[model samples]
Target: MNKPPRKKNPTFGIAVFIVVAVLLVIATLFYNAIKEKREFDSQNPDTQSISSDAASTAAAKPASGAAQ
Candidate 1:
C-alpha cells in the first residue's frame, strides 16, 4: 500500500463553533438592548408628554407662521 492514512481536518469544526458562539453573543446583545429599550419606554412617561407637547406646537407653528 502506497497511500498514506488521511488525517481529519479541524478547521471546519472550529469555524462552525466560532460562528455559533458569535451568533449567540450577538443575539444576547440584541436581546439585552431590546429589554433595556422596553424598560426605558415603560419607565419614561415624559416622552409621551413631550410628543403631545410637540403635536400642540406643530399645530400652532403653521398657523403662527401664516400671517396676513
Candidate 2:
C-alpha cells in the first residue's frame, strides 16, 4: 500500500508574519510620536502657565474696565 504526503498551510504562516510586522510598525510609530511630544514639551516649557496667564489677564481686564 502507498501512503499519501501531507500538505502544509503556507498562508497561515504568511498571515501571522504580516500581522506581527504591522504591529511592529505601529508600535515604532507610536514610540516616535511620544518621543517627539516629549521633546516638544521640553523645548517649549510654560505651556501650562499660558492658560493661567490668560485667565488672570481676563479677570484683571474686566475689573480694570469696570473701574474706569
Candidate 3:
C-alpha cells in the first residue's frame, strides 16, 4: 500500500505556535490591566490626591477673556 505524503516543511507548525503564544500574551496583559483598574477604583489614596489636585488647579485657573 502507498503511504500518504508527509509535510516537507515545519514552518506552518511554527507559525501556528507563534500565533497562539502571542494571543495568550495579549490576553494576559488585558486581564492584568482590568485587574489593576479594579484595584485602583477600590480606593488607593494616590488617585484621590491626583483628582483633588486637578480640581484645585481647575478652580485656580482664571476664566477666559477676563484679563482682556
Better of 1 and 2 by lDDT: 2
Model 1 over residues 16-68: C-alpha lDDT tens digits? 99999999999999999999999998898567666888898888775755775
Question: What is the clash count for each candidate, in the order shown?
Answer: 0, 0, 0
Off by over 4 Å in 3: 1-4, 44-68
**Candidates sorted by lDDT, best first:** 2, 1, 3
Task: Note the Cα lDDT for every prediction shown.
Answer: 0.88, 0.90, 0.88
Stretches of candidate 2 off by over 4 Å are 1-5, 49-68
Please give the TM-score that candidate 3 achieves against the real structure.
0.55
Across 22-52, the per-residue lDDT of candidate 2 in tens digits comes to 9999999999999999999999886777789
TM-score for candidate 2: 0.61
Q: Give TM-scores for every candidate, taking all chains together and pairing residue i with residue i.
A: 0.61, 0.61, 0.55
Candidate 3 clashes between residue pairs 3 or more apart in a chain or in different chains: none
Report the lDDT tens digits of candidate 3 across residue range 1-68: 99999867799889999999999999999999999988888866456566888989989998797885
Top of the candidates by lDDT:
2
